[model samples]
Target: MKLIRIFFLCLLTTNALIAQTISGFIEDASSGERLIGAAIKFNNQGVISNRYGYFSIKVNVEPVRLMVSYLGFETKEIEYTITKDTSVLIKLHPVQNNLNEVVITSSPKQELSSIDHYTIPLELVKKAPAFLGESDLFKTIQYLPGVQAGNEGTAGINVRGGTPDQNLILLDGVPVYNINHMFGFFSVINPDAVSHVDFMKGSFPAKYGGRLSSIMDIAMKEGNLQSWHGTLSLNPIATRLMVEGPLKKDVSSILVSGRSTWINGLIGLGTLISNSENSTNYGFYDLNVKLNYKLSPKDQLYGSFYTGHDGFRNQFKFDNSVYRFGLSWGNATAALRWNRVWHKHLFSNTTAYYTQYNYNLSQELTSEKRYNATTNSSIKDKGVKIDFDQILSNQNTLKYGAGLVHHTFAPENKSYQNSRMDSTAMNTPVESLEWSTYLEDEYSITNKLKLVAGVHYMGQHVQKSYFHSFQPRISLHANLTSRSKAQFSYNRTAQFLHLLTNSSLGLPTDLWVPAIPNVGPEKAEQWALGYAFQLNDSYSLTSEVYYKNMEGVVEYTDLSAFLSATNIPWYDRVTVGKSRSKGLEVYLNKSRGKTKGWISYTLSKTDRKFASLNEGNWFPFKYDRRNNLAMVITHDFSSSKTLSFNFVYNTGVALTLPTSFYEGALPSNYVHDLNNPLLINYKFYQSLGDMSQRNNFRAPAYHRMDVSYKLTKLKVNGTRSWIFNVYNLYNRQNPYFIYYDQQKLKQFSLLPILPSVTYQREF
Candidate 1:
């Protein structure tokens, strides 16, 4: 006890010796939205802002030059005398010329201190050629290396050979369970309401858990602090409107945005013209709102909510019978958060959130005896998290956090009714509790070398069983020269939930299941090595190689039924396996000038093994591709007009098919009737097919080109713009899927040569 007391006393004495410290928050000057990953540099010491835009650093008690920088923002520099503890709020202004381009640049200090992180500006996302005249953020992200889209025009993404469920997507500190609408044609996020987006593929920090592949953090706009403003946009597929302003001047603010599709109305009009007996309807809508309040200088409060729904129905009547089919799905999320500046060198944030996702399918038959059937599935999450950031000294920073979540999983529920008073109902719901705590330290060993190390401990309780994991993370960065750096990282991650999907089309019927006693949590260990160099003032290059080993991966058995209105436990129809993936990626980016964009390429291989499947042999994963290439270029013709082009080429995905067929005969017993001198026997023969290994065949290569043009006009009230987009500019018949038709294989395509237009107005 005496020795422990002495150690703590010495620690306190050392901390008291520090004479100066600087701490504050960084935000956008116009929108009041917090900026994550902003760099603050002074001499040989620096620190990046946390996710909540808070930062703290200890320095010498003398005059110094401080620099603050972020992507797409003008750099800010100031001279300060750090004589005592100080606190300040720093806001950065947007660059006028680069307002419409997605700016991704690193500060001189951050260039050598960070790795495997990308910042995508909203303007750049809007410039990409839209799919069906709708600007989609997820679609733009798919153009980057190490990421692939599931279908021709879908928002589903597979990153580094991992499924979509492996990525943890957060919107304003709340997780979004289902981010797709209209059968994956578009994402649930409204681009007009988003302020900033950050993506991390490797070297995950200890504060982020519950996912294996990547993290996409999206920050929403905090409304305009200056005045009231709104925007209205229209296209063939959908229409969107956004409004934002201060409720009580600078003390409080509110923002609201909503989008809805008009395709169903157009279809109804067409039906009226044709005078058809059949009717079909489909539509989707989403709503988002955010409110912010400043109670005091040291305290702030925020509330955010999002809700979206998709519905489809088709009905036909022939003779005396009527058939009807319907499908519906939606997502709802809400979050409440509080920020506090506890001391000059310490900051904290606490958040409470709730999210729910549900989908249902129904079928009805109208006749003398009516019959009806329906299937439904849902998942819900409620959690609370508290995080703290403390600046111990100039060379050391500490981060720690803890969170608890309650998950309710309803994998499936079915009901059937008949006119004869016969009915059936099946409902099964499972509940679980998950908790985690993590701690990390960022230490500068020298002026040219730095290290970030951390550990996360997780515990889960479900079905009268308990599971725990200890995950470790480490990253190292070494400055080889003034303009080049080398980085290495290793991370172990754990996932307590899984998504059971049988189709590659990304349907809403996919079920989300939790880990139980019989099924274990999925775990992965990843290693990455990278090198980055600043070629010149306007260009940069980065290359990385990575490998991952995964265990406890789950897949459905051959006998498992999907989208069935039956009562069966999900856990009884799955098999656990193992997987591995390795890849190399190269990217070159130009951040300035009239012509700006990026070129990226990737080479990868992924395989899986299961003891009970594929004759115990290894097979390629379904989404694996050998090579991928992408190029995007945008040229500004003038201040009012711009042209952008994008090209992509990738090897086709792998699939499994039958190789041959054979005949089999069933045995039958023979009864001998000696007296009658006759014998009778029966036998049956059936055709059986032999299948090859899983994902043993690859489809044909796929490629496409897209181009767009934007024209802008300045108005007294606000701004107006017109955009023209052409998908599949070369008219390439890219295959969406391949299937066997009778004796020959056939390929089906979804989208063809298409052109669309959108008009926008802002005030």
Candidate 2:
């Protein structure tokens, strides 16, 4: 018995002596900003850095070669032998003299391994040609295949025939209810404050839910841990600034960025130009703040907050009477998170978040104060979620999470000063609870093939109504060769809330409705197959074909009913339908060399059918186009000078125009205007007539070219740059909308040839 005990003890001691735990953070050497999704490998085994730039791996204590690689950065190699557990920070430098260069390798955990995900590097966002002299992440994403932009200069996104609201956008693990500012011309997010962006259109993992078409996960910079840095940028209409520094050296950090317009005192440029007190001012401002503190070697705490406001105020004074109209919309979000490293292979993150979006419109009369009124719409969300990542081995990794969200919605509320009509509210204040849980596993069946499978269970509760769904997702990747690959994926997604718009304009007042007994949730299933190949070491080509089917999509049955005098229940004016979308996309990108660019083309078809609309026949979706093509190029002239060019061509959107008009009765609530007693609210206030079908006509094709030149120079304390941008360089008058006038069909364009310049300084 003594001899057996001695043998077991010796075996245990030997195992402990051989195993070693190595952990550290990966960061940029110059900026001291931690890098995410970096790959670290040794002895044919590897691990990826987490979202917070932490990594841990267990390995033998013998001498071995360690390699670290990150896109757009120089890879490093080291040889080391550790006696016990070791912790070290890995710093990487950006490639010298060239910022547009990008390279992808067939690493085991590269972005493409997920089979349809895209990891857009931050450098690309900074180098792309800006719209109106401002860099926009959503605009850059719209140039990708399978994604469509709404109107000229609009930041609205429609992916794979899905509406803008259908995309689940996240910021630091918290949802953003609204991403629009300046009436959809600018997104709420400040590009300089973001660290990384991940976009997925298909084959979504179980960790994501509540969206049908796409997911955009954005990570904010965690502040510099070594030193302090700040940047200030200016444009013709807006200015922005960013600051990041360490609160406690190597222990805590903070980052703050703010953007506000200051053109003649915040959009009073119009008043300045006209020199009148009866002018209008419209502008927006955004603020972002984040703080991080290390509680221990294995635990960290984070807090982030963001708020943005857009307001339009107009006042007109005529003699002794005054008329004022104001419109405002804003969004606020906050998140508190805790990150813990339980073991070398186990990591967890717990987060509590709150988000709110609100819209307000008011009109007042000085002479008739009793007629003053206000309209408001709002939505709020508070939720807590926890996630765990368990790296079992090199062949398998398990991910699981659960969340619970309490939602409050006030669709639309109208208040009047007169006591005769008290107040009116549509889809009045309602409360709901959303609960979800997910589990997934990534298994490497072989060195050439990988399989990822997951399941998500989500449900909603509202006033004795319960809606639930079990969504399954799967993806398969096969490496055909060292430089070529093939992949296939299938995904099922569901949404418990719906955004209801009265018209195709997609105004800020669009109502948000939860899943009730009268209306069910929206669900979608998608299948995609793709192939990718690398040519030489500078270029890559990827092609994919996909099909999607969606059910429980809600649409307005009668717009006339909405304009009636009496209020109508939302469910009574809407009906459910189904939609089908299929598409083929081809993309070719250049990664290295003096000139970098990409060319993408897409062919797609989307149709919808309703039992009570369009005579129960199929019709094209309003935003559906048959063909879209885009090209982006950036040329490095020298170390301090660069040029960028962007071009896009899209087959026109589908629309319906009334061939003729017929006289119709006005709404009962419409009151005559004393200023123009004979004139109506609109010239064509009569009913729409001679309309053959919905989405039966195609608008004219849209094509535009933009160019920008950037010159960087050394400033007093930092670096400064001037960006000269010319929108519509060739002066293409693209169609923004079509209208009928004097029995003639006319096309209306929104923008003209415009040129703008921006100056940026970094210190």
Candidate 3:
């Protein structure tokens, strides 16, 4: 029996020796740099290298052709014969003056339309390193051209010469007002719950209604079809927990995610234990939930809901006693959606949603004298839309949709100066109901020529204000060749609401006001032309120029009227104006295996002509910056690890600052009497220390760098992984806001450099 066992062991050992693997390393021929994570494919099998640029794989064939590819490097295929299972080395040469890769996502069988230029995938979102492991839909799109990030911590995206508000943000076909949590440092969408994001910068599709400048569509995850999956994350400021699973075999699924800051609570406890007065406290929390079910093979149902809140507190210590003050805000949203495929060529989707936002402030001085005010707002949008998509052929397609929306806008219930002021003193709620119908056609005239055209007719009725308007859009694409294309687009749009703010800082005082009878709907006309090219399979480049003309824009005569007055409509406190913007955008992208990154630069100018100010001459817009540049790169050391770096440099944003100090606008005794009812009017005479232009002065140059590293797929048993990330690695101070205090006669900026870390686990 012992002899038989020994013979079996010897046979097993011989077989193992015969199955020895072939391994090798890849490096850049020019720079001689080790190409970590380079893809090596042979015999229908592929494997990525480790950080040491080493790879090993077993194969039956002794001789095979190995295909090696990496971004910015020429793809090479080498044939080598293996003798006695020996390791081999390969080198790849970098392509000189290679064109960047034109990475786009679109469904198969759909005609490629110029209007639908690019589609970003959700997997890329999850893979990309983000702030605190939090994936932001808007921030991810900034990597593309025609999109710019205005400030740190702010999801402000300037696209095609338009402001952030101009971009229509939609979640499952429902509009969302504020997409920020914790003021603006993070986005509201939890990466674990998102399924896809589709953004269009230039051309507007007929299937989409509302918003003029751009469209951002987000689709939430439809739960899991398999068993169950969950993740838990921890950071210095917050902790997050999420879970997803199938309710039934393959019919139903659900996902839930929640995050909350423990810093404030933990710090508060520490202060209490030490018997010390609390000077500052900040806290934020958010929740997200999604569910999906398959009613039939052709029908599906989904529901999504989100809520978040932010608060800050401070206490002033005096010799006699302590004074406490606090400021807080909150937002909530919920949506339900239904999608049904009528046939192989027709598709439809329907949605309903609701959203709310509120702010509160409270202050106490020795208890006897206290001030408290709470302002709450809610915009309930109940709507239903039916979208029909037909594929006439491989070359012709049509997408059409119609929707009806009922808006109930509730302005804040204001209470001021302690209990002396009542909440009912504010204006009554305003309700606007609107309905729109639109249709678009995408035609491929030839293999090299494509066109997209659509129009929308909108009707709004509310409080004696009736508006009927038509928005038209058209885009053309001419492929110069397989590697190049030329495109042009023209669009017209109208807006029925406006945001009135005193400063560019976007303070709480900034009010979102609806259009009234006196204030006509804002109208705009925009045109753009562009060229795109692809070199090899790893590089893509694009250049575009755009122009926009707007009229009937509203500006305030006195910033205080937007806050002090009640019962009066927004038109009574604002003045109509005109504005224009023109810009050029250039972008390049390269992504393959180990190294992936892009460079984006924008040269633009925005100007406003306020007939009521600056003698009607055009001046730069408050948020405009003449030039902006950004670069980002990511390197994969292995299949489970990566490092990301980002750098941004831009010209200063337009600002308004006093040229010199002065006592007051009025110096003569009769000047005050002459304008008794008007306070101190400076319209008739030149100001003493005026800056000449409201946005003439430029702020300091803006620049910053950030780096992060991700570690994933740590295995113990089953399907489990881990991720670690750090934001603002070098701690570069990216100024968010700069304001001049009248009392101190000095400028103050908010938020210095900040560092954050997060740990995550997935199953």
Question: Which segments of model 2 are wrong by more than 4 Å?
Answer: 1-21, 58-61, 83-87, 102-112, 263-277, 317-320, 368-370, 418-422, 426-428, 503-506, 560-566, 659-688
| Strongest candidate by lDDT | 1
Lowest lDDT block of 10, candidate 2: 102-111
Candidate 2 has a TM-score of 0.93
Off by over 4 Å in 1: 1-18, 105-109, 420-425, 504-506, 663-688
lDDT tens digits, residue span 1-763, model 3: 9999999999987766555455655665643334654677767555554323445655556566778876456889987665455566677887753322212332211223353355565545655556665656666676666676656656667775565567777765567776666667676666666654668777666666555568887666656655677878776667878887778856787888898888788878878888876567988888878777778755667888888888888897777666777777776778777766564445566667776666665656554555555545555667776777664544466778787887777655565565354344566878888888888887778777888889988888878789877989898988788688888998888777665655443544445556667777777888999887777677877788989888777777634353456556555778888888888988787755468777888888888887777677888876577778877777777756767767777777776665664545554764647757554355423434555557767777777666666666655642333445555555655455555543343444454444555667776
Model 1: lDDT of residue 44: 61
Q: What lDDT score is found at residue 543 in candidate 1?
A: 92
Question: Relative to the unseen true structure, what is the C-alpha lDDT of residue 404 in candidate 3, on a scale of 0 to 100?
Answer: 84
After best superposition, candidate 1 residue 224: deviation in angstroms?
Answer: 1.8
Query: Which residue runs does candidate 3 get wrong by more than 4 Å?
Result: 1-116, 123-129, 132-134, 278-281, 313-324, 362-366, 417-424, 502-509, 558-569, 665-688, 717-753
Query: Would you give me the overall lDDT of model 3?
Result: 0.67
Residue 763 C-alpha lDDT in model 3: 66
**Candidate 2 at 179: error in angstroms?**
1.0
